[model samples]
Target: MKRTLHTVWLVARRELRTRVQTRAFVLGTLFMALLVLAFPVVTLFAGASNAPEDELSASDSTTRLGITQSANGLADPLERKAGVDRPAISVRKVADTETGKNLVREGELDGVVAGTPTAPELFVERHVFPHLERALTTITYNNQLDAEMSRSGLDPEAVRDRAGRGEVAIVSMGESQGAADGPMAGISDAEKAQRLIIAMISTFLLYMFLIMTGQMISQGVVEEKSSRVVEVLLSTIRSTELMAGKIVGIGLTGLIQFAVIGVLGFTAATATAVLTLPTFTVAGLLGWAVLWFLLGFTLYATMLAAASSLVSRQEDLQSVITPVIMLLIVPFFVGVSVLPTNPDGTTGTVLSMIPGFSPMLMPMRLALGGVPLWQGALSVVLSLVASAAVLWLGGRIYSNAVLRTGARVRLKDALRAS
Candidate 1:
């Protein structure tokens, strides 16, 4: 047993050294790290550019109006009706109707109030602002109503006071309930949005990592078999050990790249203030992502290596490994398309607990925050169980088929081989 472990370790070390020292691995890692670092910086500048425009719009919200002598009495009422919620009304007295019209046309004012308080006429350069128009209309209507009430021997001020007091009481059930104590409790809308972003990013990275590493494992196996390298290696180490060592070595390489990218992305996002999540929260998400990757890579890599061993040439490797690739692809599309809008929906919740789907879906739910502890624990357990079974079965197929060269060996023949 000790000798077997020593052989596996030696092979793992050799594979790791070969992969890490490759030009492709070094350049790919550097490029991905740079890209991750640049994302937050780009977002920060884009937001910065649009911020000034928003501030300018808010600072210049006052509506300027000109009033002629005929409508001079309406000024106080209009000011009062404008209220604090609507835009502030800036009233200027004009000499005559023509002067007010000229002021509006010259862009010096938003609108002109002429005629009389009860029969006011508004002139504007183009369209009147909605709030300003509403205020003017309300003031005119009140004046006419007040005059009618006075004619009828009713107190207009007393009537207004009673009407003002008859406001509809608003009772919001959502607000009254306060924050929920269950999953998704107490999370603000902004935080939810941030969680969704984190979920999406996690899903994408896992998908890419799985695809890249799965292919690497399959191709590496086929390359060794085709070139008779496995024959030489097998003479020294058992087939199972060779397969185990390759999976470990390639997995570690992928893990290194994955960690570098994740750390760089989080660091950049935090430094640029793009992500408002606490450091521990971000770190926890990253930790979950790493865990899922290791589990996913193990389960898929074993099957892919076993599949590739059936074929001696790289050309036929795709036919054998396409099904495993599809397994990775289906969950990726499902999670990315469904989870963003409905992270806690029944479909995601259930699928995330399944072995094949969990690695891709569970991490997304966890990153979105509010996933129950049982669900996360169950998914991990199921995946580990599935991986162990696959590893055992895949080891048999690879051991029987890897040394067989020439035309593609059927899976049944490989499994049934002595």
Candidate 2:
């Protein structure tokens, strides 16, 4: 056991050292950190841009309404007489009716209230803009109210306050405001959904790390085979020992890379005020991330190590690895496309329970919110069991196939050799 552990450690150290020394790894780390930082920055900008602009547009059939008088003076008189807070109406006297119509069409003027020798007639070139519509609605409603109050012999001040009363509160029984409020309440209605997204993103990221590192493991294995390094290494170490060492070494290397990225991302988020990291909360998101990350890395890395041993040639890697890569990718898209809608539904439950998919699915379920302690515990237990089985099976496959050269090894041949 001590020998196995020592061999694993040695292999892991070698793998870790190789990665840290590589230019690709350094560049990849920088790229990923930049991307992580970019996400929140982009989100902040998008949120700011989506805010409503305070601009108004109004129009009538043809004539334009020019408050030929001072806007402030008109607003006060209109407020006193009609009990309406009319917005500042500026006048633009054009050459003729056509020019006035042109200005209205160009959206330079709001509604043109044409003062004929008779009564006033309003004209708009087209449909109203939202801000203009709202402002118009308010002024019109107040004007009508003032007219009604004048008929009823009520003061305009008394009428305006009564008209602007707050709306009635209607509380429903057995309904959560969080769930019922529209998409805006997604944080509350779909806290679980948010959590699921985070979990899936994290899991997929870890899965990707394993895949990249696994490829490195495979390349390392192939390099040794091609260079006749294995022949010398085998003289000192058994095949199983060598395979074990490679797996442990490569996994540790992957974890170190993961740790660097994770730390950078976490620090970036906290420093940028994206996420608030707490001191001592047992179920805090950061704590969950740390726990789930370790579990996810361990589970995926074992399978990747095993997958590497299935082919000796670099050219054969795509064929041998396609299925395993698909296994990692399918759940990722599924989690993103399907899980949010049905957090506790069929997809979530099935994927979370499945041995190969549990690492991705379980965390997603938790993030979408409301994974019971027992369910999480069961998931962890299942993942551990699955990891053990894959490791055993994969190790056997590695032991049987690592020395083989030329063509890719079939699963049947791998199993038969085992």
Candidate 3:
């Protein structure tokens, strides 16, 4: 066991060294760093430049603060008080229906409030965004202070006092399924939002890495085969060992690249205040990323090694790899689609169970607070078993055909040799 591990490590280190030294790896990593950094900078600029105007525009600012006329006079001083220091709020006594409609269309008033002893009725043409709409609602409610008084069964002044004193306890049973004990059960809205952002980022990275790294492995193999290097290497090392070394080496290279990109991205996000330092615990993300990365590479690497054996030339590489590429690509789209609709849906559960898809699906499930301990354990076990099978079977094919040249190797020949 130790010897095998040492061999894997030696091969992995050699591969890692070769990959990092390559011009393509350096350029690709630099590009990723710039790309990730650019996003936060762009977002910060957009947010800063697009600050809400100091004054709501005349067309948009015109809002009607409604009042009810009692037999004696206007109900309360609430309308005037609510609009204090706010020039945009215009109090309008809606004595007639026609006057209200006309004012709204002319943009002379943004909305209408039918004031009663109860809470006023706000009639806006459309659902306004929350901030402005909130201001309107508060002003209207104060103008007709009847409902709050009735609900509290207290004097108007007492009702207002209690309303002011009452604290808002917003409890969100997260996962959107109303399930208790979710990861978000005790978390605040801000933390929940942060978790959501992180989950999205994690999913995107998982998908991106799988696509990019898998292709890199396939393409690297094709290049080596086309250049006739595999023929020379075959004499020194067994085909299986050669393929294993390449995959391990390439996977290590990809992991290193991924780590660099992640660190750069986190630094950029922190500097921009896009992600708070507390929100970006490296240990947590690295733990998850490393686990998923291995699972993903192990699941796909053997296929890549085997597929490369089918093609002897660069041009034929695409055709041989097309099926495996399609398989890998399909999960990304399927996982993405399933993530939103049912984060823990039947489809997600099934996908999580499949060794080939467990890497992507399990991380998503963990993020969404859907994975159970037993299920997670099962997924790991299944993935290991599948990876072992793939490595053994794929190595057989690779060993038989990697030495062949001039034409693509047939599946029958590979199987027969095996």
Best by TM-score: 1
Best by lDDT: 1
Lowest-scoring 10 consecutive residues by lDDT in candidate 1? 172-181
Candidate 2 clash figure, as a count: 19
Clash count per candidate: 0, 19, 0
- Error at 249, model 2, angstroms: 2.4
Clashing pairs in 1: none
**Where in model 2 is the C-alpha error above 4 Å?**
51-197, 276-287, 290-293
Q: Relative to the true structure, how large is the alpha-carbon lDDT of every model? A: 0.83, 0.59, 0.66
Once fitted onto the true fold, the runs of candidate 3 whose alpha carbons sit more than 4 angstroms away are 1-11, 47-183, 277-282
| Model 2 TM-score on a 0 to 1 scale | 0.63
Candidate 1 residue-wise lDDT, 36-110, digit = tens: 888888877786686542232245667788999989998888877765434688898999999989887887887
RMSD to truth, every model: 11.1, 12.2, 9.4
> Higher-lDDT candidate among 1 and 3?
1
lDDT of 2 by residue, 25-61 (tens): 8888888878877865665456346532212311122
- Candidate 1 stretches greater than 4 Å from native: 51-183
